[model samples]
Target: MGVTRLVSRRRQDPGTKWARIAMAVLATVGVIDTGSITLKRWGFLGELTCPMGADGCDKVLNSSWGTLINGIPLSLVGLIAYISILLMTLMPLLPGLQENKADLSRRTWWGLFTLSTSMAAFSAVLLGLAVLKIQAFCFFCVLSASLSILLLVLSIVGGGWEDSGILAFRGVLLATVVLLGSLIWISAVDSGRSANVGEKVGVPPAVTNESSIAALALAEHLAVGGAVMYSAYWCPHCHEQKELFGKQASQQLIVVECATDGQNNQADLCRSKRLEGFPSWEINGEIDSGVKPLSILADLSGYQGSREF
Candidate 1:
């Protein structure tokens, strides 16, 4: 009789159905946001159009803190998190789960609370990095952080928890854990911080990758064609462009530092060119932005060199 009464009460309890729907919608948006970034990073998609400008988006996404130790994009992690939240949000609403709806709802609410709390905490850490460390703003990152925080708020106010004290305790503990973990992870992956010791403040890390013979020949060809590369010292995509040419080949190309504080800066020249983004290339008096592949550069510059790169 006691078990029957408990089950009956559980079934009659008014769960926040509206909150779940709202969360699902937000999670779906998050999935699309992060998924697109992941695809772009992996070369599955072309250049992404940033809301305000592409410079901040390029710098932040191509920075040292952008990828995991295994070279996986950090956006993929957020994508998985959003997908999990979306699935959990919809699980209890399945028609087949009606018999266990109350029980499932209770369990999934706890899961949502825990997951969203962690996501919110980690997003805070990323936001701090973007503002303080990277000194670049990414609209997508801000959107994800906002979504995480909103989901957290919804999880709290929408859960309709019977025990507020327990929820508070768990939330605190989860947040603390996520905070420490995020700090440690950030410290580990921040190669620029570690490599920049005693160096100029805005200088990018040196490229150590060796260039192939073909790459060197292409670099020479681009130089003869009057192709010039304009870059900012603090831009990771600029560094990436250098890495592609390798140390030896990079020296053969005519490079202009665009950052005002960068060594050998040609700020006046860069401004005259009206450059919109870093790692811009000027071939045949035509300017193009973003990191281009060696083959693309060769074609753009009308290089007849070996295309091995």
Candidate 2:
């Protein structure tokens, strides 16, 4: 009876159960963090209310450094990582998968260690980019990095390793491969949008008249609603926002140039409004930061225009 009880206990160790729970919780937080960023970047969600300044968040997220593989947002990759971690951590907890739990424990722990360490390594690279390359303070990025570190610590502590040296060696080797693989992937697939040291911000391609009528009408509605576009002449995003309006319609916008020497400059007013990010839209005294689509602008201004953008 004691031996049977011991075998039953080994089948579902209470300690490992707790560890998986902790990891799943952290991974879920990571998912929300990266998932929100991905949605916002894709324009499906409005701008994030970053705890750090909205301008700082926008600058970092929209910067060339944010792209990883062929214009894919780095947040998307992070989203995948977090989801994978969540799924893997939960796998052994399912009733059906519990049959070989003890047998899989060692391998599972090492596998998790490898994944967590890889994430930590990638997070380290991102932290460096946020500090050195982006030179922007992003609260979300920092939070994700903190989560990665915490997850790594949890993995190491929960692994229940028999040999410290073996664990360390495996961790180092796995981390190195992940880091190098990421570097190679980035180099081979980079979109060539790296912020050039002295290059002028390229103008957005002009919008053709073939653009939907709703988009053109939305621009007019924004103007009629006393909407203002606070922008900088050197801001690529500002140009892109203008291009969305097409030529004739864009002419109707009350565009305020925040650059001191820019045409129709309103640098003082922009400063007074505390404008930091380019292409910010102001409607009914509410400022929406970042490049927003015509549909969003229309909805914000309560325009009953056609939905097509």
Candidate 1's residue-wise lDDT over 109-201, tens digit each? 888999999999999999999999878889999999999999999988778876677778889999999999999988876754576432666
Runs with alpha carbons beyond 4 Å of true place in candidate 2: 1-13, 69-71, 181-191, 194-228, 232-239, 242-278, 281-309
Error of 2 at 189 (Å): 8.4
Candidate 2: residue 148 lDDT (0-100): 84
Single out the weakest 10-residue window by summed lDDT for candidate 1: 3-12
Candidate 1 backbone clash number: 0
Report the alpha-carbon TM-score of model 2 versus the true structure.
0.67
| The best candidate in terms of lDDT | 1
Q: Which candidate is the best by TM-score?
A: 1
